[model samples]
Target: MTQQTQEPTTAELSAGYAAGLDPREVAETILTRIAAREPVLNAFYLHDPAQVRTDAAASAARWAAGTQRSAYDGVPVTVKENIPRAGHPVPSGTAIANPPVAATNAPVTDRLLEAGMVILGSTTMPDWGMLSSGVSSLHGVSRNAWDPSLTTGGSSAGAGAAAAAGYGPLHVGTDIGGSIRLPGTWAGLATLKPSAGLVPLHAPYLGRVAGPLTRTIADSAALMSIISRPDARDYSTRPYPQMDWNKRLSSPRGLRVGLQLDAGSGAPVDPEVAAAVQLAAELFAAAGATVVPVAPFMSAAMLTGIDAFWRTRSWADYRALDEAAQASVLPYIARWCSAGKDSDGAATIENYQRFAQLQQVTRQATESLDLVLSPVAPMAAFGAEHPMPSNDPDEPMSHISFTLPYNMSGQPAATVNCGFTTDGRTIGLQVAGRTGADEDVLAACAWFEGVRGDAAPDWSLVP
Candidate 1:
């Protein structure tokens, strides 16, 4: 039996854990975490134990060479199946690996490898990352660490569980809706949705790439530094800066937080969630930040359309990638390929135009607001059987009302634990920045990590 020894954290392990606290040793810890919890949590869709060991061995060698890429070197991190993982089956966790191990890694993976992060394996995801409930027909459901009975949110289920279980210090997951944010919040970890172009998706889900299942904001930023670059292969990179994120100052030199007063929708937040947001507001104010109200809440109508757009657009594309490619996927996936197929071309065109208009509106309103803050999901983790609550959030039609718009606008976003409910469920505070404001968003996230109630992961209660 692997005795859990308050296992050294990402930071501590970087300094000591694996063979001499080497990353490979840290990889062993991840393998251990998976072995102990996988039977119950079922977080991974497909993890290659052999690869993990081989990578760990290399990680040890890197450490021995006094050239571990970064302190993160050797840490076996999980990747959501949606994003490309060069050569690995990225059927988004439908039917094992999709793109044959011969494919090249996603830019993020290249960055992860460059940063010395050992690729543990792919994590579970809803078919195509289209669903928000986190349960996949392929891997089943990813349970919340706080309460195994509830959802750890979705699309990044494996990423969230791996982090919550201390599988590794970080993870990589993309989010068009709340895929990244919801998982991190539900799993009680920090997550960031880089401005659309910051970390180019390269292939599918190319428009939005958010960091998920990370233990701390620093690792997320560090990962960003490695991956965010001008990749000629990715056209989206043209709009983002090619500058190095390592050049970014982690310090929040007195932030200007724009508080979303109503959070619009009259969507009543759980008292605990509300308290967490309020507490976060107070902390930001205390930390030399001037908090003020900001705008850009989606009208009730726009809320419903957001999820509709993501599902229809994502599935329609998933449907195109050749039969042989698609066959490797799950049946439920083929089912969701057109849930929103009825979305008229006119509606899509109009909605597409709305995205541009939304951007301008955000510019006018947020030109002066440094970072905007709100409840990550407006709720706590839910039951595992149903990725969502049996009873919907106030807006029953829009499960992802809070997160999708940002993805639509291509802005950077992040969720950090602010407080816990009386029932002990974790709540997250999301902070987003205007376009091209990734560094600013990261700076703000680092602030939250330092001050807000580190509500993520009650390891003491980890099942």
Candidate 2:
């Protein structure tokens, strides 16, 4: 018999399903949990109880007939609002009235549906997916599952919250900067920002890609196995070969791992966060991996350059909206993007060159190392009401220093809970690998999960 667990991890749920568990029963438990916690977490932007039950009933019938769609056929999953499902509004967490409904499902969503996974609903994000905090104009404030007063982080706010609150085993989120990792870190969830173009996206950009937020690294691998399939919609996708993502993970024996204590820009790492990440590096060393100190390669100039480029991009988006719609935006987001209202073509080009510089410098810095370890963010958590850790429009990107570079350089990065602060804030240890080394990154994180047992957050504090 499969061991009963507190959190319904993907593998455990699969085993239970195979052992005669009904999908309808699992669906009822999830729905009940969501009802109990939704007032405090505000995790879901849309949830249809009737739809969930209907889907589960079909899955239950399939199981009874000795036929199931996949190992995760009956598992419940949540998709971020930005990743569209047919007949749903893609508000992008804005205050705009009557947001446009999506006409089609995104590549990732299609894959999950094809695998017979039940979609719980769309999760929330900050307006225009710009801020790294959870105060959204459209969906209101999404709070941390561990502590409701603390921020959930964003723009993947609700996805992180759902994962932490046990809304389901898998929650899909999109990461351009630290959207996935920041929230995952603050909320004590396992999340990944895959190598750029590794998973096909409908609207692929320079750093944008979709990945999963889950309670365990093994669950993350289970999700990746389905979402990483080929999709012709993404023109920038790399040639990714399918493999057993849930394959056994071994120790980091003989691998050269780099430890980066400073980001060279943004907010300085808090002492508690630093200590937790350092301990994780020590564990790698104890497991036979050669741990070497790597100097900070990202500079203030590089950070500001990317910041300027992003502001310009956001300003364009803001200005395109009609006057009433523009006024409805989150004031912090409005103020931040307003700084780039007068940006010139020359200035925009110069600012965009920063992406190239970041890519070049990051490549040079980690060239000799198989993997790098760092703190996911400067601090553990911030106020749920604040738009960012600094709570200032002009200095918005300061908290994303550690996780942003990996996005630009196209390296796979994962965040797992390593420790907690003195006040009980969750701290995350970041594991990043060389470009195209997604499997290695997952393996290292999975191995760490095994060594760092029982660090799971207390769900009683969620409300």
Candidate 3:
């Protein structure tokens, strides 16, 4: 009745058996939960019931043979529609690719499959992973299970929503520009945007990397272990760290934590979001992580430049299509794509310089710290009716401000639920790491989750 208290899947199972719940039963229970929630939440692009059974059966067999695939074996997992899965469509939420057929599973996706995580099907993303808010003109909008009117942050919108709603115990998503972190934050889930290139992007666009969204930090780490494997199929993947990611680590306190609360947008981040971030900074300091407040978050010019480069991407590619093909895309995606086609390279160049500048500054600023913490968004998820902004792609676009810097800097960044807005929308606290300090980011985030006591935000108890 009251949702089987959510079972430990994959990595979660190793630390301890979860109330005697077997991985097989966990998969079945999650499928049942998905059936009950998907109609209202619409979290998945499509799921093959038979495939779930086949994968689960294989995982159970592995478990019986004493050779269960890592922690996630048998876990029901969902991937972002934008990530190519062999023989499936990776639409990027576009009408042009409505069928989203993929010739091969993305390297990151392949890693998950190799680990024995069963795919529940694909979740939605903004058209071409463009929109800042979850509202994709293509697949309609992925509602925030926490607050339907608001959003399930995106371009990993449905990925976050699905995880939040208990559709899958684990979710995989791409984050070129907060695709993973944003939706996870909005949906009150835990997510990581590994340093650019940490995970491979075998799909057409090369900048994005795959990361996981989940109910627990351990689940996220487990998913990462599967997805982070360097693959010969994709040249883009980095070699796996020589160290074991599963090893237990020490607390983050006593570690220097830089706080970056502002961005180049020059617009004020919501006060509530700010307070929540400060609370996080304070928590780190109190717990022994040295928290330093950094001033004048990235400049407005830098902010605008970063915003344009990341936001304009989906559209830049969109212009190559004919009118009818364009029309076939989501309304908002079409609108956004239209805007990008006209914007001169100057738009991208400005973003490029800002990116270089930010990387320089980010490196300089954080040289003293182990990590930087900040707000995920200025505002909480707005109702579905609220028109998601598609302002000029050139100047600092508003929503992407809080989340896209990492995409530009190619650094690891994470979003953990910090606080909820007065309206009940969730506020996300982002923690970014020095270039390639991804596991550290996850370790710190997991430590925070352990202290926080909540995995995904329990909306009913948010207040």
Q: Model 2 misses residue 205 by how many Å?
A: 0.8
Return the top candidate by TM-score: 2
Put down candidate 2 lDDT per residue, 78-169, tens digits, no spaces. 99999988898999999898899999999999999888889999999999899887888888999888878999999999999999888889
- In lDDT terms, how accurate is model 1? 0.68
Q: What TM-score would each prediction reach against the true structure? A: 0.86, 0.97, 0.89
lDDT of 3 by residue, 1-463 (tens): 2343544555555433223436566667777877766666667887887778778778777777778766556767888887777777666776674454788777767777777778889888766676665666566767767656667777788888887877666798887666788776677777888876667667524347788898766777777777776766656556645535564546775788888777656456878888878877777887887778766546677765555565567666666778777777766556544555555778677666777787666666667778889887776676654335434433345766656667766778887887777766677889888767878888888778766653236633421
How would the candidate models be sorted by TM-score, starting from the highest?
Answer: 2, 3, 1
* Model 1 RMSD vs true structure: 3.8
Q: Candidate 2: give the clashing pairs.
A: none
- Local accuracy of candidate 1 as per-residue lDDT tens digits, 1-463: 2334444545655667334765555666678777888787777766888888888888788778787778767756777776577655665655544334526767776777777777777777766665566576567777765567878777787788777776676678777667889877777777888777666666634346656567677767666666675566666664665544443444444777787645454355667776788788877787678888766466655555554565467667766778766666655555544565777898776655655655555556566877888887767887787635533322333446567667767777788777788877878888888778777677677766765545545565565
Candidate 2 TM-score, true structure as reference: 0.97
**Ranking 1 against 2 by TM-score, winner:** 2
Alpha-carbon runs more than 4 Å astray in model 3: 1-4, 12-24, 97-100, 204-207, 247-250, 306-316, 344-351, 385-396, 453-456, 459-463
Better of 2 and 3 by TM-score: 2
Model 1 residue 449 distance off true place after TM-score fit, in angstroms:
2.8
